[model samples]
Target: MGLVRNRVGLPAKCDLQIKAKREVCSFEFHSVPGDKSISQRAIVLNAIAEGQGTVYNVLRSRDIESCITILRQLGVRIAWNGDELSVHGQGLRGLQAPAGRLEVGNTATSARLMLSVLAGQSFAAELGGNALLSARPMDWVVQPLTDMGAVIEYLGAKGCLPLRIQGASPLSPIDMEATVFSAQEKSALLFAGLYAEGITRYRQRCQSRDHTERLMHYFGIDIHSDNDVTFLKGGNAFCAKDVMVPGDMSSAAFLLAAYAIRGVDRKGSLLIKQVGVNPTRSGFIRLLAEMGLHLTLQAEAELISGEPVADIYCTPGTRLSSVLAEGNGRIQSLIDEVPLLAAVSAFAEGNTVIRDCGELRDKDTNRIQTTAGVLKAFGVETSCSDDEMVIHGGRPLSPAIVNSCGDHRIAMTAAVLASSLDEPSIIRNCGCINVSYPGFVEDLSQFAHIDVLPAE
Candidate 1:
């Protein structure tokens, strides 16, 4: 099955319209899509477990679909009966090699995580992706796997995709401190560790998302984390359990930002229900709070899957302030939301400087450059560098046509920013929003003036 596209009468490549004259973003409660990170892991990890596992509340986005499709290609049996996903695993050593090349279009998460699963398999498998996914940095994942005895050949370009991967049986485990803050890389090595005999140790300077670690424990794998260190015991088998995915906080940020802005058509608190508010993953909330947006959380019972869910309450701010984004943990937490933060900062009183963002250049397009485009579309100006952005706020937003850069986040950010101003604006190539948040245009249109149409 292909990735799900936008369902609100949108063409493959569509444009988004945001008119500020629509109903204000006032509501008592809302729910976004299921957590994409958790949903992907729940599907991939459980598919390799010893028995059949059922996953609930899975996000049926294009990215998750990519992971599911690739896993099915690798011989896992997965079926969706209504909202429940039934995945039957052949255990740690039972995964079958695909008959042909595995195609993962525009899904870096699926491609990267699947690399580790394929790394320890006995046979060679070829993995390829679309043009955008091919350009992402796979060397970060490859070099580490190569160190562990996996034989990887680059079919296209070095450090890029279209790779021919051959497994290394009884792979060598190593102890090293991670130089990059990547949960995907960390998860890949952890998966590789499952094939090795000894204990595998991974250390990081700061915590990224811990969903992988959490899910490992949920599946009964012998994995533990202390401070910045993580240890995984190899040669262990695990069983499957029913997993519940919480609502996506990343998706909630756009709505909360609309209500939190000073002069949007909003007057009250926006309640977002049943969101995964994991501290390491919910840094966007803290980033907003730092800029004087009022937000509170009512905690929900932790899922047996180790995901923490909560209801978020956000009130629009009267006075906004500048923010500084630094440190590895802070950078990782708000990484996906930086573009949205930049768009929201345009109405703040001062310059919001974001640093430690060199990784932004590695996204679908150059996110740093695209975020600059977003800020400019909002009539905000500032200085930009390879790793830093200073958004000058308090400027009058203009009615402009902004390019989506073929990026879902950029398109969503532009649309969210435009909803707060009186002028109507257009975001080109917004159909990309379905990559992560399908039906986003329809969701936004209920509270804001937005429409999806064929791209010019």
Candidate 2:
């Protein structure tokens, strides 16, 4: 099957209407989509396992769909029933050489992780992506895999996408320290190490996301992590098991920010059900709670597929205080949610500063530049250096036109900022929101005065 465009786009025709701010007390509850991080990892692990397995509640967004399409092209059989996904594996060595190029449209996770999986196979294949995906840095993954005996050549840009990879059998294991803090890079090494001849050890300067490691342990792989170091044994086999992906915490952050700012005036409480509150991915929740928002964990946490899942309960709060986002370790946890948090900071009681976030420059767009521009469009005073953003909160915001920069998180963040405005505003390139949350506009409309209009 060919990759599908989820929505059409118009340059200036589409306009978002943001009604005047009012007390929104109507009762609101929503079940967001499955975690994209977990869904992507589960699909990869299941495809490489020794037996068939079912993954329940998988996210059905562009990113997850890209994983499905790429896996199918590599000769893996995957069946989809509603939100349940069944994968029939051909073991670690079972993937056949694709008849043609594997297209991963705009999904960095799929491109990076799958490159590692293909490194150990005894064939040659080319991986290509759309314009946005082609610009993202692949050297972080390529250099490591190349060091371990994989032959990877750049078909286009030296360090970018359109790669030609020749599989390396009996891969060599190496002891390396990650110069940059990236879970994708670390995961790529670990995945390739699964097929190596010996143990592979990796130490990170700061802790990155642990979804890959957790999923590995869930599948019975011999993996362990202590401090900032991780050890994985090669020549191991994977046994598939049933996995239930919880609601994405990143997608849930927009709702939490909405209620945290507007819920106090509403008559009912706001509850988001069964979200994956993995510590590595829960920085936004913790930061908001620390900012004096009445957020709480309502149920005991459950461990599913090595991830922590729980129900999140939030009641309206009177005000929000500023919090600092610095340090290498803490920034990696909330990296994706910084734009949302920056938008929310416009109405806080004090100035909010986010530092050690230069990595934002390397996303689908320059998030640091786009986020500051969006805040400025809404009449919020913001300033940014190379790796830091400072928002002077407690300022009045005005209705204005903003741009999404074709980034999904930027589009969602703009929508949230528009909700609290005194009048309506427009957000350009809003259709790109489907990359992560296809139901974002529909779900938020149930609780806020927001409307999605097609380009005229």
What CA root-mean-square deviation does each model show from the true structure?
Answer: 3.1, 3.9
Candidate 1 RMSD to the real structure: 3.1
- lDDT at 240, model 2: 82
Q: What C-alpha lDDT values do all the predictions have?
A: 0.81, 0.83
Alpha-carbon TM-score of each model against the true structure: 0.95, 0.95
Over 4 Å off in model 1, which ranges? 1-10, 22-25, 262-265
Off by over 4 Å in 2: 1-15, 20-23
The residue-by-residue lDDT of candidate 2 on 1-456, one tens digit each, is 111212222223355666534654543444678899889989899999989999998888888888999999888999999889999987998998999999999899899889999999999999999898898899988998999999999999999999999988878998989967878888889999998989899999898889989889889999999899999998877788889998899988987876665535553576777788888888899989888887788774776676888778877665788889888879889999999889878888889999999988889988999999999998899999889999999877888888787788888888887776557887777767878888776666645577667754
